[model samples]
Target: MARRRPVRAPEPLRATSMWRVDQVFLTRRGVRVEVTCSMVNDQGGLRNLSVTAPTDDPVQAVRHAARFIAGRGNVSSARQARVRWAREQTTTLQDELIRDRQLEDEFLDEFEETLSAVRDQQR
Candidate 1:
């Protein structure tokens, strides 16, 4: 058997992968949760990235996900909360509008009746 010399690996272009996470954020969507990462691209510009951890640890992923969750600002829990409030407001406003319409109709009906009564009295 001949002894082979070990070949050295080439230097990596960057210290970390472009998808590497500088921070993480945990986001909840309804009962489910997802992880997001904050990373600098090749250009070194700040960006929110959707990615996965090498070990697939939710806790570690959440740490990077925190960056995505906060920076991306699309958390489902908060969105659902806002949506619930909006729906409630819409329902209340709709009810009020219907009530106002009913009141207006009654007022018009009464006004016509009063005018008719005045005409009868004149006769």
Candidate 2:
């Protein structure tokens, strides 16, 4: 009798939530490109990046996504730049929020003072 080979178990899976896709755009050449975006918190930390490429052609899409996810090539560089730009935008918005709050406080103080002056004049 011939000896039978033993079956091997699959490798463990990694965390899938680390990837957050911001958008996906296809080129004229029919190549699908996905943008894995990272969110920057108030503390300036990058929430992990995500690159997901799915299409009607499962084989091709997997190949493309794997290459991009590996951080190998221009696509990877572009994704990194995009993440940096997004982080800067978040920082700018945070600054604007602080400035607007300050302005609102000043306006409320002035309005209260004007009301008090009018009441005193009527007395």
Candidate 3:
């Protein structure tokens, strides 16, 4: 077996410096909306970005904002994963709300039947 010399890797190009902004806005309804990040593009031009959430919770608002920005900004594996996770959470919450409403309806129907039976026995 022959010994092979290690090859050195080339240095990466210097990354361009850019100013970024992340802002949170509150609506009259107490909803917190946020912009994950805003920055100039490779062309030295600013890119327009809009991200908002109708949720009152600050944490949830930021996550939703990141989901929106991820779609318009760079397409990276990490960003895609975050977006997918946010969507899954949203779906799960919606399913839970539907189930709760159904349970409430069932309870109300049972209560009405019990009240009717008691009234008939008392008559």
Candidate 4:
């Protein structure tokens, strides 16, 4: 019997200079924002990555997506990268809301309204 070699993961793109944010917009899916970003893949081909931020704040969502693409980190695969990126963006947004009193108040007001609507539907 011949022994098989284990498959190694593809190396991450080291030069992120080609990466850029294409668009950032709010999705219709209540309080969700979608960020579309593009970059030159390792194969010298153009690739687009779209990630979502589960927040009502469009400004903060855009910033979070831009930072994720600009940050130096390993991106093994699109699925893995997106999951990691979205989690980081959510955490950063939460931290920002905690630090900004006005932003926090606004977010809370919107959240309470959403909750109230849901409760009305259930009752």
Q: Candidate 2: lDDT of 33? A: 34
Among the numbered candidates, top lDDT falls to 4
lDDT of 2: 0.36
Instruction: Give candidate 2's TM-score.
Output: 0.21
Candidate 4, residues 68-106, lDDT tens digits: the string is: 544423222221122112333544656433333343333
Model 3 lDDT, residue 13, Cα:
60
Indicate which candidate wins on TM-score.
Answer: 4
The segments of candidate 1 whose C-alpha lies over 4 angstroms from its true place after superposition are 1-19, 51-123
How would you order the candidates by TM-score, starting with the best? Answer: 4, 3, 1, 2
Worst 10 residues of 2 by lDDT: 74-83
The per-model lDDT (C-alpha) reads: 0.38, 0.36, 0.39, 0.45
lDDT by residue (tens digit), candidate 1, 1-123: 999999999856765433323433434444444444444544566755454434344344343433333333222111111101112223466643332233223323433454455556659
Predictions: Cα RMSD each: 27.7, 23.2, 21.7, 15.1
Candidate 3 lDDT, tens digit per residue, 20-104?
3222222223344433333444445554455556776645554555445434324221211111122233456664333223322
Q: Which residue window of length 10 is worst by lDDT in model 3?
A: 75-84
Once superposed on the true structure, which residue ranges of model 4 sit more than 4 Å away at CA?
A: 1-26, 41-44, 72-123
lDDT of 4 at 100: 33
| TM-score of every model versus the real structure | 0.26, 0.21, 0.33, 0.36
